[model samples]
Target chain A: MREFANKYGTVLVVGGEGEKCRDVAESYGFRDVITPGDIIKANAATAPFRALTESEIKNSRDLLARGGKLSDIVVEAVFVFADSRDWASDLQIMLDIAQSKGGRLETRSENFDEGPPIYFSHNDVLWSAAHEHVRLGMGALRKIVETVFEDVTGGRKLKTHAFGKPQVSTFEFATRLLQQWRATQHGLAESEPPETVYFVGDTPESDIKGTNAMNEKSKNEWYSILVKTGVYQAGTEPKHKPRKLVDTVLDAVNHGIRREMAKLGTRKDGKGRKLPLDDAALKAISEGRTPNFDLSVDPFAKAVAQ
Target chain B: MREFANKYGTVLVVGGEGEKCRDVAESYGFRDVITPGDIIKANAATAPFRALTESEIKNSRDLLARGGKLSDIVVEAVFVFADSRDWASDLQIMLDIAQSKGGRLETRSENFDEGPPIYFSHNDVLWSAAHEHVRLGMGALRKIVETVFEDVTGGRKLKTHAFGKPQVSTFEFATRLLQQWRATQHGLAESEPPETVYFVGDTPESDIKGTNAMNEKSKNEWYSILVKTGVYQAGTEPKHKPRKLVDTVLDAVNHGIRREMAKLGTRKDGKGRKLPLDDAALKAISEGRTPNFDLSVDPFAKAVAQ
Candidate 1:
């Protein structure tokens, strides 16, 4: 998140019930807040968007039963940050905004068909909330859109761009960010470059595949370090193998930075830093509190079935 | 074929334009013949229905166009026996007729999204017609209906039932017929059941899988015998193992019946005396004339890719 906020400038965070998502981003210095409910209320009567309950059946007394829609809110970066409280309403609104004919929710076309891509931030289709049962998240919405798109297009497959755990995109993006950061901190200039970037992740699919594909296709060498502290557990030796294995995030980060520095002839970890990654830093990230909530999902065991 | 006609009682033989398709089926003892043009002449308003070509592109005027729909033809049993000369017309017409509610012609409905169970005698998808490239057959027409159905129905995947080689339905029907024939030919009563119905085919997937599945699941047994002279080659080993490998149909038939007799308490070929599957007759069925048509675009292969 330190890297995220720095590189991407002031980001407007969206989606969350009454600012839970907004507050998390603001705490990380995002400095902006916008919610879908706010948008729907601010502009009514044309967006063709309406909110509904978790269950799909029409409710007589629902707020949206009286026909109104949202005005599109402009945000350069958007994320479907949390499990939606209302399934139909959020789906209708999010889909409306995402596919809003060049981003004007008030001016929507009257057809149920292919639409713009939604950047859902989390992969967990079901997560344990305060309730006894697991709650549905962005993944569930993603699956719904996928099915709906296909259904509307008469058997044509849905086109989507997804980037959470197990997807190659986010890890690749993160690695590129790390490469620039590591080189600048180590005083590497145009004439020099960092030799390697070690990706320390717990999931085998995304982390391992990212590193493997990176190793296969790029000049920025990355070593994969799979940690046992998160998504992947003991006993399943997946088809792809990581460069190294570790038991915890602190050990992974410490070993990763040190190994790269040693290999690159750099004198320290990220310019004059004599210490390995700090225990407190690792603890914060591992507890799912370090990076801005929009940038990262719960790092503990997420049921990312989608 | 004899059993199919008897079981169906009335097989409408279509596709012989100006007597070619009809000539072929009549030679095979199919008496009823109906061509598409005959229907349109009975109703002049739809004379344009016959104006379809196999490839209905705007500039395929050189491809002989047929004029008429399948709507006028009454068929208790259907055997689209040969490669279509004008697929666009045959396809549109057959599609219209098959989807007609309660088998009535000229009666339209919104639910053209599905059709009743239909059978094709030959499962040839593409075959050489003395042309340099493979030409379209009834299989191609079937595919067109499927594509259109998917396009109009909100992209719901169309579940079509097709017959011909490689579709288990056709082979299952054929094998059942063979078993009944065998039981009656032998002294076995209708109460006495089939032991094994050996299929000697030049194709691997249709013959091999059909025999294997039927053997595994049916009370009557099935064994696949591959011949090198047709769809399969001598050096090829099918993905699914056949019960026996033989270079010629004659050899396969001889082997299967002998093996069956060997299973019974007899060293004889069981000819004429209450059991007529002799070595000579087995050789005759195996040595019968095989057509020049292709049966290689097997449904099992299609299913595997799907």
Candidate 2:
């Protein structure tokens, strides 16, 4: 994540964690993290204003004001960062803007067949939650909205750009970030990406499939490791097989390090030499604790702080 | 249609025309005619009898009736005959019955994933009306309901049985009616079907395709004649090509009769001999007029009247 932020200079963190996630990203030296709310507000600001009718204005006691040209309004794209907390209002507002001409409220689009592009951060139909049963996720909501769009358009397919696990866009973005970070850190060519990248995750369907697909598409070697934690467990067949299977997160880290060491013909096990990654750092990551690092020696962290 | 009614003991007429269509069908010797209203009423009658609460009963001034077992209610199939007039209420009632346990209103299904089968008489997304442009039809309304159902069911696909001109069910029904009429008229065995049948229609996509498919599936031979009338205009390429194309309904009938006479090796023009189908009667039928028929000779009509 630090390497990604350093490469991008200003990273945008999109998720359902709201302000807390933004604060965390800022703490990690990300300066341009934004939320769906921010996008919605920006879109609303340029909305073509509709003046209240005479009767409505009178009822409002002259507090309502409206002065804006419809021609000045244009919404480039609408993004869904995460699963909405309030679906009805969120969908209603989005539908209004979608059906509006030039992003103008109260003005219907003359060509009702088309709408602005819609993007989503994730598209999981069902996600494991604290409850006994799985909860409906962002994908389910997207399906509902798509169905509604088809209905309103009299049976036209809705166009959408969805990203997250199992989609190529997020992996492409991540690869670009890693390449930029490597170039800034080691003075390597901007076009040169990492030779080998290991992605460790528990979910086989999304995480494994995505990494495998990205590996097939990209020039760099990509390996996926599955750990028996979170949603996945041992002795069960996975939807998408990973490159390595480990009992724990620590084991997954060790497996990746051993593979790299063997490939490089330097299998000393970090006994009398400084290693790029060690047990202490790997343990900290496995425990979900941010490891302490000296920014002076850590090129990625140093670049990120700046 | 008169010939069809004279063959079938009773025909179920489902549509938006309500009592007018029912009366017309009855006049044509159709003893059993059904509509959306009839289905709605039947479903409503079986709705679980929820006892009015204390305040609600008191508010009713002792006129409210209650105390019925929910087990007594069960709706097997739901049918949509045509475009709904009161969409909100109709949708609400249908949803209630769908989510109900065994069609018991107010009782949620334990499975939460299954529902009674839904049937649609027509599935047109839009239709030409008196107003300019196309208007929402029964099919459009069905799409909206299906979307809502998916939303409520957490992305489960709705089970639907739709039948219209383009669907094979309608064509099969038409063929069965024709066969029944032929058997009664010629004193042939019930197992016997016509050696050759002619289907004349204006629309190519619906009427022609359905007839062609039915012909492929049935033992009897079927030929389609396309006429330039109603929805099908001249010079437009049809999705489903017909066996013959004619300028008018009269020409279509003449074409079919000519082919039949040729096959029988008796190619005499109608002017010198009494033809099986009189031109005057065919003309009246083409103009949508009900011609007088001898009821004593019509077994189905006599059976229906009795």
Candidate 3:
């Protein structure tokens, strides 16, 4: 991602882990990372749409004492990467910023009645956790905030952006990241990008739909293969059909290799070259190992701080 | 309303002022009343979904020391009459009660995923209060609780009752009250109830829509009169049209008297008999006098504490 941004332009990142995400992004050589909390802390000096009251000043002092930053904040967009840890405070601050005058706190905008466009990276309403029941995810929180916003604005339409699974943005980002890696690591020419990419996953809705949507927009083709190891059980019908159904990732890999070789016109005696899954890779697969395909724009150290 | 309740049967009341409203209703001869706060205080024993913590015990001791009552609480329904003074605590208790097993404190229901039906009497998101900008009203707080509930339930449909202003429930209740008043105070038989009622108000949506909906269902008729003394201003389109638009409540009364007299075939020389508006009534209307329509089952003394 760092190389991709360097090659193309700057990459703007946002996350839910407050300052930790920002720090991690910075460590990975990616600039411009922020959270709603950062925006609120920056606006602490001017809040409640007037000269700061004594109590407001005292609260600001306390927040500064507890390690808040002061800066001139201007928000062009908001991208939510995960479920907010402090939803009440985050929602309050975001609403304030969205309703402020040109993103200035303590000042009412001429167009303060309308909220700004919001984006979330994922659409999982409930995610499995260690608890007995599923925990509320970003999608659920988004619904709550949307409902509150609608109520506050007297049925004003709420405009938002949804990415990640079943959306094109995440897949596009991942594809760009892969191209960047190919160019920077393997010295591939920029003009000679891969013609097609295979997306293999166990979930039909997010993975398959995202891949298909990206394929519709991109010049490159995306072949989505559904595996039966995770959410997709063996006998269930998939919500979004993939290019092929496979029992495991190994089968997906073999299928992709043979198809690509055949496309390259490298068939010999009506057979294309196939890639064999090595013993180590088979053992890892048997042990429930899968490659970490998500390219990190941050470091593990910063994630640990959260 | 008290006479009406006495003649017809019983009436249950609820309010935002908790015990104060309850006391007022009792004083007015009402038999039952409940508030969201009362439900919370009653469930203080089973808070945070656990046994009473040490802090809880200490808080209970302090509340008792401060003249709080000690009584076993049982709640069949919750009604919000006005803006809650403490929304966080009120919401927490309400959610607990709604999720509790058979509404029992400290016991989780096997079917806890579905929340109880919540109701709010007013839907004014923001109202002119003793402040500069509008203060958050019962409607705004209700939206917050609803959002929280949806988030907790992972987008399960929210089942609720919204009364007051344009909703059928408040109008139905008011109509019943009027019927009871006619029977008890005027010695009118149940079969001789008024054929038509004149509902005079300044707010268009709440007053007019409620009357219109009630008229749709009732065998008798409801004539809505919009007045311009309060929320409704002159030269503005009303959300709900009224039978007569007037400058004041006096004009509304006159209009209703003339219309009803004509309906009774008592017009003489194309002129109908008029109801006299006495000096005191005129002065009261000019001075913006409105009856305290909110029936309180709680005590006035407790409301004063608030």
The lDDT leader among the candidates is 2
Per-candidate TM-score, chain A:
0.52, 0.58, 0.58
lDDT of the candidates, in the order given: 0.51, 0.57, 0.56
Better of 1 and 2 by TM-score: 2
TM-score of model 3 vs. true structure: 0.51
Question: How many steric clashes does model 2 contain?
Answer: 0
Model 1 backbone overlap count: 11
Residue A124 Cα positional deviation in candidate 1, in Å, after optimal superposition: 42
lDDT string, candidate 3, B156-198, tens digits: 4446567677787677777678778988897777555477889
Ranking by TM-score: 3, 2, 1
Tens digit of per-residue lDDT, candidate 1, span A1-306: 444444443233434555577567666666444455554444332122243223322211132333653332343444566655444344444544444444444444334333344556666433333322222335545665555444322344544445566565665666566657767776555333445667776656556766777767666676788887654554557445888887887667667644643433444454543434456644544554432223255544453432
Q: What are the fnat scores of the candidates, in the order listed?
A: 0.00, 0.04, 0.06
Ranking by lDDT: 2, 3, 1
Docking class of 2: incorrect
Clashing pairs in 2: none
Taking chain B only, the TM-score of every model is: 0.54, 0.56, 0.58
Report residue B201 deviation for candidate 3 (angstroms). 5.9
Better of 2 and 3 by TM-score: 3
Could you tell me how far off, in angstroms, the CA of residue B250 lies in candidate 3 after the best superposition? 10
